[model samples]
Target chain A: MPRWEPDAVGRLQAAAIDLFAEQGFERTTVAEIAERAGLTKRTFFNHFADKREALFGPVSERQRELVVAEIAACAGSVSPVDAVLRGLQAAADVMFEERRAAVARRREIIDANPELREREWGKRAALADAIVEALRARGVDSGTALLAAGVGVLVQQMAMRTWAEAADGRPLREHLSDALLSLHAVIGQRSV
Target chain B: MPRWEPDAVGRLQAAAIDLFAEQGFERTTVAEIAERAGLTKRTFFNHFADKREALFGPVSERQRELVVAEIAACAGSVSPVDAVLRGLQAAADVMFEERRAAVARRREIIDANPELREREWGKRAALADAIVEALRARGVDSGTALLAAGVGVLVQQMAMRTWAEAADGRPLREHLSDALLSLHAVIGQRSV
Candidate 1:
């Protein structure tokens, strides 16, 4: 076991993002990331399976857990998509709204690296799966659950894109709500 | 210039799928793929940017173009999402419904290869972009176009999944319609 363990996961993530943005993700090493965080490589490994994991693993997993829990807590009176939107709102309240700059930096880092971008895509897909399971548990059928979950994730993507670009400091919760409305309009239009 | 060039693209793709499945995609070589198709390496290179490109490039691009063109040709009265569904239906009629087994095998090959999986994701994203552009050309705004396009792709994904399962042997166009109804129900339930 390594000795330096001061919020090792957070430290590793921040260091990895900073280093990836600085030296390019492919050129950066796990050892360098660990060293930047002032932790042993063993400590880094303990926190994350690898450098890419450090970038997205913990935070995404945490968000997934929170969203699912929130969805489960919702009553049957709420619509499936609304419950999902509420869960996404709860997730935004917890995981993203407070960490805007850091999340933006992380997105920038991932954008700069093709492998990291793929890993991010994989993480988004995994999160959609979690949302689908949560919706299913709320009595939605399998197919509808999958569709609602996908729409929710798409909303999240649009909100994040806007949030990252807006210098006026609009809150993610507001953006999330806006995205949900956009989704509704998109799906609500009358087919001639 | 290589002499052997009749239906070179199709012959090469069929040859590659056979060899990759028979000898494993990782073990298969471009030279072997070319020889198996009765074509030279120069002919293969002239047709595709690389070996992986042979598997996915032309078909996906053509599919996207076809969908977008079909959507654009629809009467101006069709709703954005409905236009997208029509586009998907048109593509399904031509590109997918006629080629179930081939697509199934291609999906299996992509499933087995991580790089191919990422490429599939990228292709889906590109298709979404194409749909969004077509919607915009029909006077839909950017934000709604993105949302409509994303929802349309979600429908396509749900349809694809249903089509892939052995139990759902219905034509892909039917599945696409079913998916659109499912989307309607999910978004319709919202008490906005």
Candidate 2:
């Protein structure tokens, strides 16, 4: 029997983050997370398969959806890299800007744990896959699509690394643009 | 005491690849690999830690060393992306160019196996990290260095994917150059 609880997933996620922060991720248990969220173990399982999913669950899929949709919606006039940046920036605005704190903490925890870092890479590969499909839908060639997706992923990672520790509270989208510019300079291309 | 054997590692790798091709990777045994090489299983253990390592062992570390050494030898006037390409080309000439058939077979086997794919990605990450270190030593800024390393990796992956499939017998260095040009075109920059 499922409890008809609104935002059960949200509650569970918040509870898991708090518990993961208080006790190390290795020490945190599903039972403790459930209790912290005022839910049962059944509800926890209903929402997430395991304790690690508690941290990686909600945002990863949704952000991918947002980016893919945005890429699909991009006009054909946009270059592949620009299209990817637009998609990434759109997702940043909708999914990341408000959740910077949680995103940073999640990254920190993942960085500290080798297992979580591996999972993060898997998640990244999936995102790139979706972007490739999205670009293909827009008539982009396979090689260009793959290259653009790889560049987009690199920019996103660099932006996230800076965005997390930035004291000036810059938006992730700007950081993404800046990273792209840095990449251009590194490649000896004129600034965009 | 180990038996004195010349080219034991090379013999083992060739034997392992042949056996892995004849039988599936899952069904192939280290003992069989050693036997195929006309060496004892003891010799196999003396050379490589496991079956997987037999495939990945010798080339990866040596390739990284070649890349790092070449990057260090680049003149100060060389840009990061060019410096990386030179390093990669040097390594490709020394480690990969002459071994196209073996490299292609190894890639085919790795691509078909999930465990090998995971190890492949880990190796790619390590190469990127080594590029980062090499660029840092050249006085490149961290952000640009990271981006350049990432770009180099993407170019390398794209080149490898094509190099394995190309019937034209193109050198991996030319493929790398083409991939980098594709990236610039994708990003709407003038091809270098």
The model with the greatest DockQ is: 1
TM-score, B chain alone, candidates in order? 0.91, 0.93
Model 1 CA lDDT for position B119: 68
Error of 2 at A101 (Å): 1.1
Give the Cα error of residue B191 in candidate 1, in Å: 7.0
**lDDT tens per residue, model 1, A91-114:** 898889888888888888877776
Each candidate: RMSD to true structure? 3.9, 4.0
User: What are the per-residue Cα lDDT tens digits for candidate 2 across A129-169?
Assistant: 88999999989889888998998888899999888889898
What TM-score does chain A of model 2 get? 0.93
What are the Cα lDDT values of the candidates?
A: 0.84, 0.85
Which tens-of-lDDT digit does each residue in B1-192 have in candidate 2?
667789999999999999888787899999999999999999999889789888888788898899999999988888889989888989999888888889888888886776666666666777888999999999988888888889888898899888878999889999998888877766664221
Candidate 2 error regions (>4 Å): A1-54, A189-192, B1-16, B19-54, B189-192
Best by lDDT: 2
